[model samples]
Target: AKLVAATHNPGKVPEIAALLDGRFEIVTAGQLGLPEPEETESTFVGNALLKARHAADLSGLPALADDSGLSVKALDGAPGIYSARWAGPGKDFAMAMDKVAERIEATGTEDYAAWFTSALAVAWPNGPAVVVEGRVDGSLVFPGRGTRGFGYDPVFIPAGESLTFGEMEPTAKDAMSHRARAFAKLKAALFD
Candidate 1:
């Protein structure tokens, strides 16, 4: 079956495609000329559902969308839904990293505890939508390292791992990523 991934980011396309490989013929919304939907929701599930439903309606196909972000316990889950915008319009993650690091430093608490949370939503043209979530708990580090992943991956270290997401190879990161966990659940619901 053909499925629509409700996003235009080329980076995400490959990651998700790899996860859903062979199960469906995945296509991006850009290929169909579908405009990106406005994310007006307050939560990951809401935003994911909004995007997926919009894409499914426009393309008349099953659509998948994900909303993932870094939530710092000390910051009361700040930059949760706003992680993308935290980097601003140009998506300058460097500045965002600095800002986050500075904020943590200001607290005078070296507690770098944080978690990456991902919520995946799938919407069918005429069926009730489904949502699944996954998370990877870890700590944040200053002076970000590596260049493999993007958007705060360099500063966030997963639990029981020495390297940040950006430091690890794509295959290594994907094997245990929060998005991978969420997608696994979605895959099981659909194919298992």
Candidate 2:
């Protein structure tokens, strides 16, 4: 099966490809010359559907898309759908992470409760999209540790782990990531 991975993010592309390993020959939207659709939707699921449908329509193939973000309870869930926006067009996630720390410090927020959320959508050219959402609860840490994963990985401490996602091996992070949980559900629905 040829699946269109409906995303332009270089980081996300390889992760999704790894998840679909041996199941399908994944072709990214960039490979097919498919332009990215505007993520105008308010929620992660909504944005994922938009991207999946756009890619499916343009490529005439089954498309998979996931929209994810870090949501902080102290921040009132801000930087949720806007996680990418926080990094801005330059995609400087380090700066964004710094801003997160600064904001938390300014607000005198001692509670570091937060979570990562991922909403995945699968869409075919002819119709509706199937969406699944998953989350991993954790807390925030300053000075962004390690150097492994991308986007906020350095600052996120999973519920029971001492190492942040950036500190763990790729396989270890993939084993318990929010995206992994969502993909597990998606696999059950589509392949089981």
Candidate 3:
């Protein structure tokens, strides 16, 4: 079966594809020239379902989507659903990271407690859809570090680890990432 990874972000494609692990030939929504649907949903799971259904309906194939973001405790869980928007039009994460630091600093507290959430949804063209969510608790770092992972990776240090996501090897990051946790559930539900 050809499964659609319902995302326009190039960075997400590889991660999703790896998680799929050859279960099916994967094609990204961007590769299919599918326009990104508006994420009107206020939560990660809601948006994941929306994108999955949209892609499945359009391509007549099963589609998978993930809406993931960082939520900082000090910032009151800000940039949660709006994580992508924080990067602005150019998707400049450096600016976004700086903004996060600034916001935390403005709070006048050093609490960098944060977590990443990943909500994954799988929808068929004419059948029920499955959704799951995962999270990894961590803290934020300033000045950013490394250049491996994308998005806020450079500024996030997962719990029990000293390296940011951007500093860890891909396999290492994948082992404990929010997306991986969500995908584990997905694999069990749909593939196991």
Best-fitting candidate, scored by TM-score: 3
Among all windows of ten consecutive residues in candidate 2, which has the lowest summed lDDT?
13-22
Candidate 3 C-alpha error for residue 22, in Å: 1.5
Which pairs clash in the backbone of model 3? none
Residue range 13-95, candidate 3, lDDT tens digits: 87887777878899989889998999999999999999999999999999999999999999899999999999999999989
Q: Of the candidates numbered 1 and 3, which has the greater TM-score value?
A: 3
- C-alpha lDDT (0 to 100) for residue 186 of candidate 2: 93
The local lDDT score (0 to 100) that residue 49 gets in candidate 1 is 94
Query: What do the candidate models score in CA lDDT, each in turn?
Result: 0.89, 0.91, 0.94
Sorted on lDDT, best first, the list reads: 3, 2, 1
Q: How close is candidate 2 to the true structure, as a TM-score?
A: 0.97
Q: Where does model 3 exceed 4 Å of error?
A: none
TM-score of each: 0.96, 0.97, 0.98
Per-residue alpha-carbon lDDT of model 1 for 54-166, expressed as tens digits? 99999999999988899988788988999998998888999999989888888888789999988999999867799999888999988999998778999989999999998
